[model samples]
Target: MTVVPPLTRMPHLRHVLAPVLAALLVATVIAVGPGSSPAAAQQAGSPPVVVRGGGWGHSVGMSQYGAFAQAKAGRSHGDILRHYYQGVNVGGANVPGEVRVGLLQNQPSILVRSSSRNGSQPSAPVKVNLGNGQIDVAWCGGCAPIDWAIAFEGGRWVLKDTSGAIRGEGGGPVTV
Candidate 1:
């Protein structure tokens, strides 16, 4: 029988009993608080930065519930990596995106963030990095638990309004 050494050997996940749990807890807190930027507050004319969190992504490395099939398939970490990172080559640790916010609930949500110089307006295309939460894929887009926008246009991502969220389905070709 083929034997896989272990799940996580990295110093970070060294002690699953502690480090991993701590990390998960941290992610949970961030997710449950208020997943919004200060700009969102300014837009609402609110003074204090609101705390937002509790996204479905688990706010951790990988959602245990989501990747169940992947693990069951006996795919090694390398295979899993390849499955997730289709176009990009995972050779070095030189990951892109400065990670303005590592709190993103997605996996490797890489995006070229462009910002206005004056800082008067919010950035365009929120550019989120969700793992398995796409409109077609993450059926819950309408009621998707998390609003961790990986990308936003003119300071928003979803096609709905600021207060307008999705309910059932959308994102397909519109017919007249």
Candidate 2:
């Protein structure tokens, strides 16, 4: 069998261990409190000291303050990312032509309302029921309301007009 090098030499392992090592170091320093002997504090039976640290983001990844300082000192986006995250090659990658992001996950339903600009009255709100698979679409402003029935059938949402004809089939988002 061929011999393999240690996993610690891997870039991803190095990146993962660096933060853990830093946290352990900080914890050790705090446990052995500065300006006071640990034995003395234990003998006095004093309460645990609470130490507050600075910065706005979590310590699992790149530090917000560290990135801000780097940017203030004239660092590019790629430079910052490379500095924080190892095993990542920045730039020279193919970019996607289009990106679709799905929002409002786990929401039972959604209510949409029309607005009139410049201190005008708003129209009636339309309710889209996602959990039960039904939608009540509002037609126009100030006219007799026409309700269009839409339901989820066979894993796809089908929109039907007033005459009960299948207009279109969609997944989540519906357009009237």
Candidate 3:
């Protein structure tokens, strides 16, 4: 028999292995469809990939459980708030001004009203109308309307202008 070089000692080993490895990778990808976890796909009556976690409200800022733990560890309420909100002065002061309240409803309008500390006639109710996909800022006693065209880009809401310049962006509730 003619002496043949071993696969490891062959000059074209890389070329021979490249296509084989690529085919294997493609086959593996096809076998495991996108996000098809074995536990998720194999269950007889799985509840559609249910994710379980624990937390209340928006999960932002200080948590109630955290405060309870801190209090149990001999930390006071003031200490807890200070720890949660760093570099912030936690105190109350008396300021004299009319309290303005803006009530935003499910509809695209804000009912604006103001009331003074002392019993006085409340300001006339003003309805600030916001157009569809339009965010307005109260400026110079009028609404400065910014027409936003929002789109889902890269897994987040991207607020863009008519010229496609990104103005603002957020994944959750956007104030502006």
Assess the local accuracy of residue 78 in candidate 3 as a C-alpha lDDT between 0 and 100.
62
What are the clash counts of all predictions, listed in order? 20, 0, 0
Better of 1 and 2 by lDDT: 2
Task: Residues 1-176, candidate 2: write the lDDT tens digits.
Answer: 96334232333454444443343343343222223333443434444322223334434456767877997999975676667665555554222222222133244423233334442344644555433355555456565445455665676666556676764555654443
* Alpha carbon lDDT at 151, candidate 1: 38
* Residue 165 displacement in candidate 1 (angstroms): 16
Candidate 2, 9: how far from true, in Å? 13
Error of 3 at 108 (Å): 22
Name the better of 1 and 3 by lDDT.
3
The estimated TM-scores of all candidates read 0.20, 0.28, 0.22
lDDT by residue (1-176, candidate 3, tens digit) is 97333332334434333323333333343222223334544435433222223335633345667777987999965676666545444454332221111122233322222322343433332222222243432222343333345454564445565466865544523333
| lDDT of each residue in 1-176, candidate 1, tens digit only | 97333333223332222323333344343221124543432334333322343445444334444455776888754455444333323343322221122333343322222333443333333332222233321222223232232333343333332244531222311111
Better of 1 and 2 by TM-score: 2
lDDT of each: 0.33, 0.47, 0.40
What stretches of model 3 exceed 4 Å from their correct place? 1-57, 94-176
Model 2: which ten-residue window has the lowest total lDDT? 93-102
